[model samples]
Target: MIRAADPSDAVAIARIYNQAITDGSYATCDLKPVSAESRIDWLKQHQPPYPVFVWENQLGEVIGYSALSPFSIRPSYRSIAEVAIYVDQAQRRGIVGGRLLIHLMKTAKKLGFRALVALILEKNQSSFEAAIGLGFQRVAYLPEVAKMKQQWEGVIWVQKDLTASSQ
Candidate 1:
């Protein structure tokens, strides 16, 4: 089941996210795992207007999560949102990420968002393809945008229109 994340699920979310960070699929450098308290504080600090959702398995575990944050602080950019999706390493290739992203897009549209964007590491082809499969277009490629482990990596910015008229 896919639903809004709760404070209690922070621990599970942090565990999954930490796995990604450690595996180098998420962050290129090693980082300490985030605590449940921090996750709960984040949930409390940003709710509704900015949404965070989770996908739970039959066992009621958080297997994946997705979120939409303001694209820019300017008032005119209110209709635009930047999105991020993450799934448990064990849950990858099981469609969890796809499902969570679709939910995020639907929710974003319902929230009156005009555009949804995802910034992906150029080397992460799976993520790039997934975004395209979900209707996002490759809008830009930022060369050597970030350096990780002494290697420079590019960033691909993908976008999808969420307006009814866009369909």
Candidate 2:
């Protein structure tokens, strides 16, 4: 099940995200594992139009999470939002990530966002392809944007139009 994340869900969210950081999957550029306390603050940043959601298991554990953040601070870009998703290492290559993304898209449209964008690491083919499968179009490719583990890696930018007609 997916629901709005509260402070109580911080630990599990951090655990899932930290696993991705340590697994070297290049799912995220964040180099350090975030603390539960820090995640609480991060959750606070996502309010109203922007939100943080968690995918919970039958046992009530947070197995995955997704968030919509400001794509750019420029006032002209207010209609565009950036997306980020992370699934538990144990649940990789499963339906969890895709479902979270789909949910985010719906929520973004409802929140008055005209478009949603995702910046995926070039090396994470599965994630990049998943976004494409969900109707996001490749907008651009940023070369050597991040240096992970002493090696430079590129990024792929994908965008999904959220206008009513897109549905």
Candidate 3:
């Protein structure tokens, strides 16, 4: 089942997120792992309007997670939010990330977001495919914007216009 993430879910969430970070996943470009305590702080930053959600197993273990975060710190950008989803490496075949993205899209619309954007690694075709499958369109590409593994990598920004769905 999927539900809103709380401070207590930090440990499991951190473990899953760290794995993606270590594996150079498309969610982020970070190369270091962070502690649960830090994750708690991050969770705290996302309050009611933009909350984080997690998928749990029957045993109550967090296996995947997603969130809708403010796309920009400026007040004028409140209608746009960023999407984030991470699934445990051991649970990839479960399609957890796809489920999480679907959840985030609904949540974004419910929270009055006009659009949801995902900044994905250009080289990660699977992620791009997943986002497109979930209704996001690749709107822009920034080439050689970040360096990782001694090579310049790019980011593709995918966005879903929420208003289009209601009309």
Give per-model TM-scores. Answer: 0.92, 0.97, 0.95
If ranked by lDDT, best first, what sequence of candidates would result? 2, 3, 1
lDDT of 3 at 29: 86
Q: Candidate 2's error at 108, in angstroms?
A: 0.6
lDDT of 1 by residue, 48-160 (tens): 68988999999988889888988888999989999988898988988899999889988888898999998888888889999999999999999997877678889899999
Best by lDDT: 2
TM-score of 1: 0.92
Estimate every model's Cα lDDT from 0 to 1.
0.84, 0.94, 0.89
* Minimal lDDT window, size 10, model 1: 26-35
Over the stretch 9-33, how does candidate 3's per-residue lDDT look in tens digits?
9999899989988876656788778
Candidate 1 Cα lDDT to native? 0.84
lDDT of each residue in 72-162, candidate 2, tens digit only: 9899999999999999988888999999999999999989999999999999999999999999999999999899999999999999999
lDDT of 3: 0.89
Displacement of the residue 160 alpha carbon in candidate 2, Å: 0.5
Candidate 3: the clashing residue pairs are none
